[model samples]
Target: MKLILIRHGESEANFANYWTGWLDVDLTEKGVQQAREAGRRIKKANLAIDCAYESMLKRSIKTAQLVLEEAEASFVPEFKTWRLNERHYGALVGKNKTEMTQQFGKEQVQKWRRGFDEVPPLAKENYFDRRYDGFDRRLLPKGESLRMTSERVLTLWQDQIVPRLKSGQTVLVCGHGNSLRALIQYLEQIPVDKVDEIDVPNATPILYTFDSLLRIERRIEL
Candidate 1:
């Protein structure tokens, strides 16, 4: 089976160098173009996507739609889940990233951004929208370290993704940078400390071919 992973294209937050965890934001025109180009690249690779997954965020949802449309696989089943959403930045939400780096010092901000267990400062209130209404409020994140993101994300991976892959379905996961990183950390079994060195660029696609047992046979960037 083939599995493809792609981070959502640049958002307005990215353009402004801001932290936008759990903030609903739209993509810029450049971001839209980036997503389209990603689709074209996948089309060139001739990989037929059978099923797709995305986070609840529109940025991720739209990217998956565009990719499947571009790859001529628009009819594929698409799934969206809250667990696949971006890591919550808590009090860091809407703050400028560069300024945070300047104020907090590079080392500290880096820890919050990339460290496995370093959670950002918690938000004072729960600002989740109606979309999250059915979920238990206590389960919502105030802020999340990579470890926390992994715990929730991997639950969906184990429960939902593994089943389809085992059924011989080709899957496409379009997600945010940190969420995708958590998934990648699990898939590749990368050392947690070493994960800081990994960076997922916007709209770029990574393809993994798997054996019948779902073991990774090979990986390639499309």
Candidate 2:
């Protein structure tokens, strides 16, 4: 079975260089162009996807839709799951990255951005704080480290995604940077410390094929 993973296109937040976590912003013109290109690339590759999955966020949904449309396969089965959403950046949802770098120092911001087990502190009762309400209250209140994100993603994979893969379905997962990283960690069995080093760029599709034994036979960055 083969699985294709994709990241959403650029967003307004991406253009403004702000933190976008559960912000629900739409894609920019450049983002749409990127998605269109992704669609073209996928179509050219002649990959026939059987199943599609995306984050609840519209950015991922739009990307999936455009890609499928370009591939002439929009009629395929697809589902959405909150488990595939971006890593919640807590209090820093709309904060300016430059200002954050100036205030907290670039090193600190970088640490929070890329640290495997560390999480930025949540805002004190704000929009970003409330975004986690749907999740387990206890886990939400405490905030989530990337390690924790990986654990949650693993739960979803073991309980849901793996079953579909075991049934010989080719899956396409559209999601954000950190959440996708979590999925990669689960699929590739990468050490938590090194997970941040895998840079999955915006709108790029990664394809992985597994043998009947469920071992990876090919992993291609398409």
Candidate 3:
């Protein structure tokens, strides 16, 4: 079985150099091209994905569509859920990273961004969104540390992704940096301290091949 994980192409927030947590934004022109190139890469690899998954966010959803379209596999099944959404940055949402560093000092901001258990200052309340109407209140977090994000992400992984892989199906997961990182950390058994160093670049695919027992046989950037 094969699983490919790709982060969405750079968003307006990413281009503007700001923190974006659940900040639904679309792709820029460069982002579109990047996504297309990612598709070409996958196509060249001759991967025949059976099922695809993405976050409800437009960036992720759009990236997945573009990938499949370019790969000439638009017919593949797609599943979108909030469970694949990025970690909530709380009050930091929309805040500029450089400016935050200036205000809070480098180390503190680094901890907030990379430390496993370091949660950011909480947001006032969950934003009203129809997509999350039936979501569990606890899962709709004010702010999430890596540990917090991992818990919910792992739950979805077990419930949705594992079974398909166990049946020898290929899967493509399109998501954000932290969400994919959480998944990668689990799949590769990355230690919390080192996991922060692993990045999911925009529109780049990381492919994982698995054995019958579902252990990763090989992982590479495609």
Candidate 4:
């Protein structure tokens, strides 16, 4: 079994330096080209992609579609789940990073961005915070830290991805950087502190192979 993890291409928010968690934005023109290039590259590699999963987000969906087109495997099953969205930056959606740094100070911003357990204050639009809206906010609520993100992704792996791998299905996941980072952190057994250092470039894919017992054979950048 093999699992391929990919990040979506550069989004307009990426060019604008805005926090885009659950914002439902689309890919930019350059992003489209990048997606095509990613597709072409994946096609050239000729990996046996059996099935796929993506975030409900459009950029990831589009990237997955483009990659599948390149791979000539558009007929494969593709599942979308909100569990794979990027780390939601509370109260920072649509804000400019440079301006944010000027106002909040770079150190504080960096802590919020890169710290493993530190989650930013909740978004003003708590309605947008689907993870914690109506389900007893005081107890067993869910907005995610990077650590929490890892936990969620690992649960998804255990419940969804791993079973398919054990069944000898080659799966692909197209997800956000932080979400995918969370997955990689667990998949590779990397330490919490070092997880943030794993830079997942846009549209880049990470491939992992598994043996009969579902232990990882190797993880490679493809």
- Among all candidates shown, the one with the greatest lDDT: 1
Model 2, 81: alpha-carbon shift in Å? Answer: 1.3
1-222: candidate 2 lDDT, tens digit per residue: 788889999988889998876678898888888887887887888888777888778898998998888888899988877677777777887899999999999889987887887888786754434445576655443345677777766777788777888898877888888888888877788886787688889999898898887788999888
Residue 195 in model 2: lDDT: 74
Give each model's whole-structure lDDT: 0.92, 0.81, 0.91, 0.82
Alpha-carbon runs more than 4 Å astray in model 1 = none
Model 1, span 9-103: residue lDDT tens: 98999999999888989988888988999999999998888999999899999889988888899999999888989999889999998999999
Query: What local lDDT does model 3 show for residue 121?
Result: 94
- Candidate 4 lDDT by residue in tens digits, 113-164: 7778988767755454463355464433234578877776777889999999
TM-scores for candidates 1 onward, in order: 0.97, 0.90, 0.97, 0.90
Cα RMSD to native, each candidate? 0.9, 2.4, 1.0, 2.9
Quickly count the clashes in candidate 4.
0
Residues 1-222, candidate 3, lDDT per residue (tens digit)?
A: 899999999889899999888989899989999999999999999998898999989999999999998888899999998888998898999899999999999999989888888999999987857887887777588999988988988888999899999988999999999999999989999999997798889999999999998898999999
Report the lDDT of model 1 for residue 195. Answer: 91
Q: How much is the lDDT of residue 65 in candidate 1?
A: 92
- lDDT for model 3, please: 0.91
Q: How good is model 2 by TM-score?
A: 0.90
Query: 52, model 3: CA deviation in Å?
Result: 0.8
